[model samples]
Target: MTATAELVVDAGRRIAQDHPESPLAIAGLTVRYGDKPVLFGVDYATPPGAMLAIIGPNGAGKSTLIKAALGIVPKVTGEVTLFGRPQAQERHRIAYVPQRAGVDWDFPATVLDVVLMGLYREMGLWRFTGARHRKTALDCLERVGMRNFADRQIGQLSGGQQQRVFLARALAQDAELYVMDEPFAGVDAATERAIITVLKELNARGKTIICVHHDLATVAEYFTHVLIVNMHKIAEGPVAEAFTEANLQAAYGGRLSGAQVTRLAGASS
Candidate 1:
C-alpha cells in the first residue's frame, strides 16, 4: 500500500463520520446512446453538503449516469430528482462543470468571459453582463482562488487553471447541486488540492456535489459518498461502507483481477 493511498482512506473514513443523508435521488434511471443502451436501471443518492464520487471501469456508463441526471442525455426509463424536485424544474439550482478536455480552450475567450456565462440563465439572452453579473463572476473566481487570473486567456492557462476556471463558472451559477465530470483529470497536485478545498467549502455551504471520478486511489479521500457503477450501479452509500472490495469487484468485472485487487486492498487499508 502506498503512503498516499492510506492517508486518503483514513481521511474518507473521518469525513463519513461527519456527514450522513442523501440529498439527490435517482430511481431506475436508464440512458441510451442512439439505439444502444448505456445505463441500466441505475439508482443512487447523495447527501446534502456531501461529496459523491462515481467510479467504474472504462465504458461503464459513469458519464452517462451524470448526463442522464442532468437531462443532457436521452433516458429510456426512470427519474432523477434534485432536492425532491424534478431536475427539469430545478435547472437554475444545478451547476455542471464538464471535463476540461471536453471544452475548446482556443475558442478566443478569456477566463472571465467564460465564467460570466454562468449568469446567462439569469441575465437572459439579450441582456449584457451587468455590474451585478460581473461582481458575481469575480466573487466566484475569488472563491476558487483564481481572482488574479480572471482576465487571462483560457488557452494560456495550464490544465489545473482551466479546471479552476470551470469551477468558478459553476460557482457563479449559485446552484444548490453541482455535477462535475472528471475535475481532477491531468491536474497537478496543488491544483487537485485547491479544487478539493473549494469543493469542501461548497459542501459546507450546503451544496451537494457529484463528480465522475477516475482516480481510484483518491476516491475514498475526495468523496464522502461512493457510487460504484458499471452498466448498472453496484453499490451506493457512505464511502467507507459502499466502497468495499465486493462492490469494487462487481463494478470492475474481472478487470481488477487478482493482482490488482491485492494492490488496491493494500492501498485502501
Candidate 2:
C-alpha cells in the first residue's frame, strides 16, 4: 500500500485486497493524540466465528484500536467495515463490553437495570419494559451466574461480580459479534473461568469475539486468532501463525525470548 493509500482505504484506489466476509475489517486505521501517533496504518480483519485476542505491551494502543474501530475515539484516517459493510451501517449487529475500570460503578443502577439497558437497541429507549424484556434480561443474567444479584446495587458488587453483570448485559444484546476490553483483568480465578466458559460457548454458537487481552499466557488457550501490535501492525493471523517469537519480538522490541514466546502462545518456533 502506498503512503497516500495508508491514510485512506479507497476500495478503488488502495489495495484491492480486503476481507470481504470478515466480521470486522480495519482498513489502514490510524489515530493520533496531538503529534504523537497512537496507531499507525493498522490493517486487520476479524475472521468469522473467531475468538481473536489483541495482544501488545502497555501503551501499544490495543484499546485505542478497538475504540477507534467502534467509534469511541477519533481517527486520523481509515475506514472500518462490519460484515462486509460500513461500520456504522452494521453496528447494531455488534455488542461491546468496555473495561470494568472505566465504568461508573457508583451510579445508582441495579444489576438488572444494567442488563435491561442492552435491550434499547431492540426495544427503543422509550419502549416499555414489558414482562418479555424483563425475562430476556433475567435470562442473560442467569447465563453469567448473576441471577441472584439482579436487584443488587452495581456499586456494592465485587470486581468479579461487576464484570459478570457487564457480560450479562452484552449477552442481553444478543449480537452476532462481541468486542470486549480485558474481561479477565483483575478478576478472580473462578470468575475468569466462568467468563471464558461463557465466551467459548458463545464462540461455539458462531459469535465472532474480539477481545483486547494483556495476559500472554492465556492467549493460546482462549483464542483462535491473534493480532500483535506496537503503535502499528506487527503480526495477525491464527495463533500458530501470528503469535510466533519473531512476530512478538517485532511488537515487543526483542525483549521476549523464543522460549518465552513458545510458552506464552504455544508457538512452534
For each candidate, how many residue pairs have backbone atoms clashing (under 3 Å)?
2, 0
TM-score of each: 0.87, 0.93
lDDT score, candidate 2, position 88: 86
lDDT of candidate 2 over 16-120, digit per residue (tens): 145677888887788998989999878887889999999998999999999999999999888787887877888889999999999789999999999998888
Q: Estimate every model's Cα lDDT from 0 to 1.
A: 0.81, 0.88
Best by lDDT: 2
Per-residue CA lDDT of model 1 for 1-269, tens digit only, reads: 25644554455333333333434567667677887878876756576777889899999998888888788877776656766666777788889988899878998999999999898888876778888888889998998889999889899999998999999999888888899999999999998999999998888888888899998888767788888888988888887777777778888878888666556645554
Error of 1 at 68 (Å): 0.9
Off by over 4 Å in 1: 1-22, 262-269
